[model samples]
Target: MSVVSTDAIDKWLLNRKWAPRDLSAPPAGSDLAPVPGDPGMPLLGHSLEMLRLGVRYGLKRYETHGPVSWVRAFGITIVAAAGPEAAQVVLANKDKAYSQQGWTYFIGPFFNRGLMLLDFDEHLYHRRLMQQAFTTDRLRGYLDRIGDVARRGLAGWRPGERFTVYPALKRLTLDIATDVFMAADLPAADSERITRAFIDTVRAGTALIRLPVGRWGAGLRGRKVLEDYFRRSLPAKRASDSDDLFAALCHARTDEGEMFSDDDVVNHMIFLMMAAHDTSTITTSAVAYYLGKHPEWQEKVRAESLALGESPPDMAALDRLGTLDLVIKESLRLVAPVPSLVRKTVRDTDLLGHYVPANTLVSVTPWVNHLVPEYWPDPRRFDPERFAEGRREDKVHRMAWMPFGGGVHKCIGMHFGMYEVKYLVHELVRRFEWSVPSDYTVRWDPTALPIPTDDLPVTLRAR
Candidate 1:
């Protein structure tokens, strides 16, 4: 069972006192239009409902209030926008009205100065330098490291009648991240500690209380631990000519000869490590669950894997798993590893004709958009063929299937992430056959990132 810390309780009490008063009020007689929807409750507002209902909460609000709606969550009134129009407006940020500071309320403290946290010109500069680390040659080298680490990690999993796949996959992805990003073999104890730190940092984003105690406190502590770890490891990385991401970042320079400062490297590493492992784990677990439920799809993907014969196929062979690619896209649609992207309005903006004030938090619910019937036919069904050439449902909108997000601030490691997940799934299918009960349903714990409440139990057999 998950433990709630005392600091969390204290933080909750403090949050109630700190709750905003105009949560249910409209954006005050604007010439444009007011966004619809109630704040839901006093102090707590729609926060608990959102945490409990997850994607359903957003969908219901969208249906009731149209594309643009307002709800009080996390102690403030946030404009929740659904469907492709909202996604395009917010993600594209063509008006320069949205700022990445929306994440500041949640992850800014833990992941300060990371690329995603920057806006405008600063973001472009950092992104350009970081691009050097993800060039084709660099990605190929990372793929080699991912293959080796995934094989080693999978070798430790013992198949049983009932096995919880999520935790195992989480550890495997973290191991892969360590190998590819840091190029260091962490001892078992260190790996466990680092994994815990990453968990805390991520979970802290959704903490009910803003106080620096309990789960929130752990998140703060985790940030320091990561800072220390990266700082201590920096000198060695700076001196080495290693091909790993850490070394690349250390030596990364722009055509203008600009390079990241020591502080920048540590901050970016903490953020990148969390981003690299956490999203991959979520995507892999979702793929495993769907494959277990659909045996035909499983067999089809497995046959592709078996034909390769290589335990960890090379980049060219990995590309040839066409069926697996479809399954990955469908799985991402089904569970969307990073469900929603957050932004804040830097200046007053008009969204779908609704006047949104400056400093308002905005939530772009891509997960909700992924489920809208208008864009996706029979939205809940697990049909990878929707991604196939003939249907191409995702083509309905440029932002329709945004599991990796969209626009300039989209995930930098997206290609690397996809490669890592594909390799792990390929290896797993080749070595094991798994299933969940036909009637089984996964209840995701809606933290900052969604994870299965029961850790995604399944029956496994070694082939």
Candidate 2:
């Protein structure tokens, strides 16, 4: 039994008063429809089921109902659209017709107006300016920085030692992100505090009973503490430039020579911080898990890395690291970090010829698409060769490979993301050999971002 907070509900109710139409349910005869699920108390719909069971429950609904199913969660009706074609259409459409802001409103107070939440012109405007940080040169620079960080972090892993590696990857990525993006050296203790704060924030969002002083409340408070700290630090950062994403964004200028306002920088930084750390952590952990389970694949990747030989992989060599790339692609398909891509239809619109009434929430989950038999031959298998030359299974379906999302606001950091992941793999293969525990049964915590449920306990042996 998940609990809804009175204050949170009150806030929504009040916001609805000023924007009555936005709060209205989709007009009754919309072409799209919802799949029926186990009953809940009246007025709650299947909100509890959707939140508690996460993707699995929705998947069951899809299996029974069809590709598209509507169910209520968090006081709103979310239409989970499965299949590649439907996903392509919805993800391809941008702006007022589709609202990212509405879909992400649960964490709105925390994420605020970060690039991921911004829509239409605002999203484009900020994205264009921020794009400066992801240019080829910038990506190369980020790779150099991340490689160093990964080397340092992996140096601590002892051989023949058993330990949970998921949390360590999370910690590693945060430290890398803080250094690479924020130019901050956040101490281990402080970094741990921030990571725990984020865990509490996401946990608070899903807790069945969100009491006033509970997890969600603590998350909001944690956010304030974070915001105040960054707000004060921005001035100092502005005065001097550094080789980090924060300084880059702080001093970034568009063609028109406009710079980010202090508020914009702060909000965007918070969002980027979370996005970079969590997504990278999950994807990297997934790679480690797969490699540990499939030592053959690990050797394949190791050979690919070694062939690149002593010199750091240049763009050409990076592309030549086909096996390495395939491993990443396969791992991402198996365990998509951003499993569910969400949006809200702002206007009554037709998706895949099925009409979605105004204000209806739209979700396209990659977890299903990645495994759809039509796009993948043996969707459940962990085979990187499927992604090799002439076997591009992902190319079989347009939406088949969207771990970083698609369309206008598609992960601006995507290239940067791949670069970092590849670097982590390159370093891991070069330094250590790892394996999962014999009793390792894989599961995921899907509430916020998908992460290994058992914390990915694994055994490490130095190479």
Candidate 3:
């Protein structure tokens, strides 16, 4: 009888495609001593690990070292910080010391200095203008617009057919963002064009080697395509104030009466579209995967949808859908859309009792904290009840649930994101009964958020 070799088994589990062998060691000059595990290749750092393995590497490092560890990725030194205290210190206490510009620098040439990429006063100024678009009254208006688009998108899906939900949901969200934010009726063809451009752009963010005329070049070309397309639409969008967020941007101003120039509006619109569509797509897919795998939770949400009925439920009704809310929150915890928050140290600072040198890249990984046992029980299980009343797995630590991130820089469209996912799930459960295949397994692609490696296979039946 032939026996399986332990090395072969180890190699099989650590498949280089998903898990790189090069990331199995830490770099010198970096104080990753607090944490154990590989930080990845020389000159490459943990960049590939961050892209391929998602949050597993950080969690392992945190589990071994402590709340803080140092590592290098993509030729940059990163300090991985975990735990509630660490989270509070980084996100709340001293944001000025940590800038979001470090991670977004690559995308800056493509996305421009959008809100999330800006720091200090510039971030504040832009955030103030963006806030107007998400006001209570504005969100109510967006609810009507978002609901119509969501329902229409769901209605178009044929029941019982095995389709890739991520791409479809991405198309759906992109269309919704364009219509609700730009007041632009992007035909399916144009929507696909724009979505493809974004996919390429985000893919470029994770590419290690920028070959001559490679993904990076393609991304730059894609950005030009996006910028040109939006620039043409700017005049029409700016011609009159429409209810769409693009319209809001056209006329948005600070207290000093400053407003975005036509160029500013175009760039900002592209950035907003990318952020909303990508995050919404990932989070929606995660919730769908969990619901498909667990029919009990699916039924719980279906009943809530039934109560919601044909009309778009008001904010109160939407908020009262507590069971569904818990499931969405739990899904985010399990596979956060943005697994890691990257910041560059503006000044030398001490983090978790270590001297972090200036220019060091500080990374706070939500994927790690989400799995830490101290904050969550059975960190690997799909227990939405943990988020429900009494259990409150998230309540264990403020930083425990950072799927949407935290602080003033917290996702401005968070409530909107939650509402969109909740409504999308409500509509899906109301229209169809679905479940994951018996032998289905999900692999995470850490490149562009945590997406199902296999398109999230599911069997759907008409209700």
Q: Worst 10-residue stretch by lDDT in candidate 1? A: 14-23
Name the lDDT value of residue 133 in candidate 1: 93
Model 1, range 1-463, lDDT digits (tens) per residue? 9898845753453333222233233355656766776666778877776776788777777776788888777888889879999999999999999999999998988999999999999999999999899998998999999888888888888998779999999989888888899998999999989999999999998888989898889999999989999999999999999999999999999878889999999989999999999999999999999999999999999999999985568888899999999999999998988888999999988888887888999999878989998899899999999999999999989988999888999999999988998999999998899999999999877767889999999999989
Clashes of 3: 2
TM-scores for every predicted model: 0.94, 0.88, 0.90
Question: Candidate 2, residues 373-437: lDDT per residue as tens digits?
Answer: 77788778888988877877788877887888888868999888888888888888987888875
**What ordering of candidates by lDDT runs from best to worst?**
1, 3, 2
Candidate number that wins on lDDT, 2 or 3:
3
- What are the runs in model 3 whose C-alpha is more than 4 Å off? 1-39, 93-95
Better of 1 and 2 by lDDT: 1
Candidate 2 residue 196 Cα shift, in angstroms, is 2.1
TM-score of candidate 1 versus the correct structure, residues matched by position: 0.94
Most accurate candidate by TM-score: 1
lDDT of 3 by residue, 251-273 (tens): 88787998878876777777888
Q: Superposing every Cα of model 2 onto the true structure, what RMSD results?
A: 6.8
Which stretches in model 1 have alpha-carbon errors above 4 Å? 1-31
Regarding TM-score, does 2 or 3 come out ahead? 3
